[model samples]
Each structure stands twice: as structure tokens, then as C-alpha cells.
Target: YTFGVGLITYLCSKEIYVMEHEYYSGLSIGIMAIVAVKKLGPVIAKWADGEIDKIEGEWKQGREAELKVLADAIEAEKKEQWRA
Candidate 1:
């Protein structure tokens, strides 16, 4: 940036160059970027949270199925032992 400014100053025979227009333009762009992130942050987080909740629910179902299978196996073993 300094090099660009120096080259422009040298070419124009001026110590200061035009920055007012670009500065405000850049500031506005930065502000817009901040606003966009702020507005989207919660919505994106909610979507991610919902996806996480869905995955958790799926894991819970799988865990319940595994527990049921274990319980059934135990019940069958107990019955067989009683018969013996």
C-alpha cells in the first residue's frame, strides 16, 4: 500500500492522493460484511443445531435397539439356565 501510494505520489507530483472515495467505499463494504455475518450467524447456528439434534436422535435410537437386543439375549440365557 505504501509502495502504491509512493508511486502514485511520484507520478502525480503530489504527497497525498485521493482516498476519501475509496475509504468510504471500503468502510461501507466492511460494515456490510459485518452486518451479513451478524444476521446470518444465528440462522446458521440454528440449522447446525437442528442437524446435531437429528444425529443425536438417530444415535439414541441405535443405542435403544442395542440395549433391547442385549436384554433379549439375557432373557433367553436366563430361561435356558432355568430349564437346565
Candidate 2:
């Protein structure tokens, strides 16, 4: 959204001012980038945290399955020892 507006602004500025004096252009871009980060940073952080949670859940499920398998094996070993 901001990028689109910035692009249009840059194109228009280029056409009107020939972009020879690039300070304004650079400033506008810098400002836009700062605004973009300020606006999107928390959203991005939340998304990253959601992704981390998903991976952690998957890891926990895998560990639980492994634990179940190990427990079953241990139970069988104990039963065999009791029979012996």
C-alpha cells in the first residue's frame, strides 16, 4: 500500500523534477521504509512467533510418539523378564 503510493510518488516526482536532485527522493524512500517497518514490525514478529509455536508443537508431538514407543518396548522387556 505504502509502496504503491511511494512508487507513484517517485514516478511523478521523476517526471516533474527529473530526479537530478536525489536528496528528496532518498529522503522519501527512507521515510517510507521507516514507516513500513514501524507499521509492519509487530505483525511480522507475531507471525514469526506463530511459526515458532507451530514448529514447537510438531516437535512435542514427535517426542510424545517416541516416548510412547520407548515405553511400549520397556513394558515388553519387563514382561519378558518376569516370564523368564
Candidate 3:
């Protein structure tokens, strides 16, 4: 949008100059940019949180697998000791 604005500004420089720059184009652009950011912020945050949750779930699964392996080893050791 900024690029498009720059392009329009470049193309209409003479017309804008003739208008004596009375139009609050800069202010309007700023307001629109702010509105866009406000609207997108929550969506971006939600996407980031979803990604973090996926990574956290993978880590949890890995930890659980490691714990199970250790538990099985300990059980086998206990049985060996009993046999001895």
C-alpha cells in the first residue's frame, strides 16, 4: 500500500502540487496504516501462539518417550536383582 501510495504520489505530483497540498493525504495514510496494524496484531499473535503450542506438544511427547524408556530399564534392573 505504501508502495502504491508512492507510485500514485509520483504519478500525480503535478496535480497534487496544483492542489496546494491542502488534502490531508499523509494523515489519512497514517490512520489507515494504524488501523491495519491494529486489525492484524491479534491475528499474528494467534498464529505465533499456535506455532509455539505445536513445538511444545512435540517436546512433551519426546519427554514422555524418554521417561517410558527409563521406567522400562528400571523395571528390568529390579527383576534382575530379584533373580540374583
lDDT of 3 by residue, 16-64 (tens): 5444344578768889999988999899999999999999999999999
For model 2, residues 3-84, the per-residue Cα lDDT tens digits are 9999889888779635556878898999999998999999999999999999999999999999999999999999999999
Clash pairs (backbone) in predicted model 3: none
Best candidate (score: TM-score): 2
| Residue 32 lDDT, candidate 2, scale 0-100 | 97
Model 2 spans with C-alpha error above 4 angstroms = 1-22
Lowest summed lDDT over 10 consecutive residues: which window, candidate 3? 14-23
Q: Give the C-alpha lDDT of model 1.
A: 0.91
In candidate 2, position 61 carries an lDDT of 100
Error of 2 at 80 (Å): 1.0
Tens digit per residue, CA lDDT, model 1, 1-84: 999987987856753555567888999999999998999989999999999999999999999999999999999999999999
Which has the higher TM-score value, candidate number 1 or candidate number 2? 2
By TM-score, how accurate is candidate 3? 0.59
Candidate number of the best lDDT: 2
Per-candidate total of colliding backbone pairs: 0, 0, 0
